[model samples]
Target: MGRLGRQDVAIPDRPSVGYSLLNMAPKHVVVIIPVFRDYDRARQTVAAILRCSVPSPFSVRVHVVDDGSGDGTAERLSEQFGGRIEIIGLPENLGRSAARNAGATNISADLLLFVDADCEPSDDRFLAAHLLSIREADVSMGVVEGQDDGFWHAYQQAARVRRDRLARRTFVAHFTTQNVMIDARLFNSVGGFDEAFKGYGFEDRDLAIRLARAGARFTIAPGARVIHRDTLDLAQVCRKMGEAGATTSQIFASRYPFEYRTLGYEAIDGQRHPWRGVLAKLLWPVFQPWTQHDAWLQWRLVPFKLRAGIVRIMVAVSYLRGTLRRHR
Candidate 1:
């Protein structure tokens, strides 16, 4: 019935950080979802989590942080879930990392599960899987499956392959915040997510690097899966890829220089194949004729693989351009 903002909630003091699981109880879990403007998707994600039947040993609490959506997101969610879920509304858009940190700070639970508003749990056993996995591992990173098989979907699938390959050798290589369960103490100790990443990328990997440095062991919870309901068309994908490049140049490259190299910026260098950047840049002029503009390019004509390859080159050029811009 009432709206809750950032200043309204208080984060309790935490105990000293330690690696031993015995020091903390893992029964109490708080699932934090940070939403920005996407009201319908957030509602579905919350509904799916509530539908989950977590066993008695585990008590679950759901908290939705509306990051200044200004789209009646808080009102809609409150009307739907009411007292069942706690909603925290910020005065302005604080980005995903800051929003999640704010939600984490407000709850005093043994385990903190961070799930994006765009993701829906695959099954009712979603929380159960993370719970079971955390018994043996400190931080459990779950799987994210794309709901559609579009260009962005194919790109995500390929990226997942690389991530999976890396995950086999070590847990520190790739960390996505989409569906992850982490110990509250460990999360708080590592200072949650780096708020400096004010945009749409790399905050999770930055947190992973810090968590690894803090001796937190990361493991895959294959059973805990979430369906990514949000799909990006080619234009949206390009914009996101550009954002990724910009973030890497501004934050990761300077903050975590060693880990930045692992991102493989060189593999997709458009400078080597000049035409890649030239052609991608040409999209602006090529699509200008269409009144609907970017929307007109959404039609899937080329093979997904070929489109993905071209998009990758465009993303690479965007990244390099972003890096250069930051330096300037």
Candidate 2:
């Protein structure tokens, strides 16, 4: 394994690499993938990147950060790819933001492409598209195409609506770290993602907000598409939305008061809705039991429209409850 000549920093319980040598061409980029307890998916993503063909004047190095999976994810990656890819195993689960920050800290590449473990590029031109986009925009956000299922189809449809709604806005409130290419300088300028956002949700949006504030232009690079291997069942989808909704008060509300108020949540006014809270509590037991059912079975039983409606209500109520709780 060849090591780049850069400063070595220790990451507790893991081997550290020196900074990337500056001598490489300007387009030399490092693809950082952060994984937690999903070795197989990570392997596939890495393999896809390695398989992808990039045009000349652009080179790539891959670094996989195992966020304390303790599941031998690091070893499995090493066994499979050997020295072709670098694996950094954290001592404990530090969440996505921390894992990505750690990965960025180790590399000295001018351009950093952050790809989630569960996302694999759709074609060989994925990297090339992102690299080309960086010439015009500071942040090139790629689209994430999910698997062909009712849930994913519904999710995509909803996303289209939001995009249409915000089509004319200066900064559309949408950003996904699932597939994004950012200049290393711009990434560090905004201080990267907020580590405080520990769990599933607005970390990406938060970063985008900060980037926008810093005058970083974000452009869509549809050609740099990736297929997200992981898809949620009705229950999983509800749970994730609820989890994300919960963070609204702490992260979004305080940072973007205008957008927070626009979302129509009472929490923005520092008011608590006791009835909504109680209602959410009552409905919990009913929905709680359903989360355990097989996802495929849930899809089979519920029509797409009905399921979509239910999910929207669940997420909204869950978000309301979260906001109300914070105010209380």
Candidate 3:
């Protein structure tokens, strides 16, 4: 019931006042969660952030960007949090890149935190962790840990962990956009997220890669974690994979030409189980144009069966287009 600081937000009781003050700082962190269609999940994410047990030397101004959601997400947010949380409702459906840019444009904070609507910050120190990292680096990546007990969840978690491992080691450039913190000044200087990446995939990776290439200091904050609720059904998964395939080629060609040229997509073929690789190759034609395909291929160096077929088709199309252009 006790209001903490000028924000007038209630801070939960703690036995040790000094411990509560450990992570709190004078400057506040602005957290932005971009939402499109998932109102329920987005609302839950904001609630989780509000409930987080972080210290409170300063209060955080959380922004929920509802990117033209048909769901009453904006109304619910206003009714529930009202002045405590700010809601930005877009008239049209701008993709994640655009929504994030809009959210960042309105936020004036010492540090900016970008998180997906489906993810929740792990603990109070999550913001402090980012601040520490930002003091030394322009951008910092937080780990998105998923609980894997059920069969489907286990499978997905295994695959994601593999992707994270690759990101930490060889492909550090492709950090997950689910939970990341960036210096507001540097983000603006880089022109923010590229709105050209209209789809779901590659936009975050593109931004990070570009920043690193431009000599922006990049580092990982292992302690700052977020849990991503990636509960996509088979059909939804395939649809997302298809979108990945479509955007990945463009992403790769623009960002990692050397990697593409050197190892090619063939690099991931032998890394995973034989059946999974074979199955992916078999489905390539069905899922190739999707964004996830590009991600899977880039990190795993293997192809989904349907996506591979689509990629071949796309390759043929590109070849034909190139020939026509040369002729003209």
Write down the worst ten-residue block by lDDT for model 3. Answer: 1-10
Best by TM-score: 1
Cα lDDT tens digits for candidate 1, 78-150 = 9999999999999999899889998998567999999999999999999989887777657888999998755
Q: Can you tell me which runs of candidate 1 are displaced by over 4 Å?
A: 1-17, 168-170, 266-303
Model 2, residue 148: distance off in Å is: 0.7
Provide the lDDT at 11 for model 2: 14
Query: What order do candidates take by lDDT, descending?
Result: 1, 2, 3
lDDT of 3 at 190: 73
Candidate 2 wrong stretches, greater than 4 Å: 1-25, 170-172, 262-274, 294-303, 324-328
Candidate 2 minimal-lDDT segment of 10 residues: 1-10
The candidate maximizing lDDT is: 1
Clashing residue pairs found in predicted model 1: none
Model 3 off-target regions past 4 Å?
1-26, 53-59, 168-174, 259-328
Which residue pairs in candidate 2 collide?
Answer: 6-19
- TM-score quality measure for candidate 1: 0.84
In model 3, what lDDT does residue 235 have? Answer: 40
For each candidate in turn, the TM-score is 0.84, 0.83, 0.69
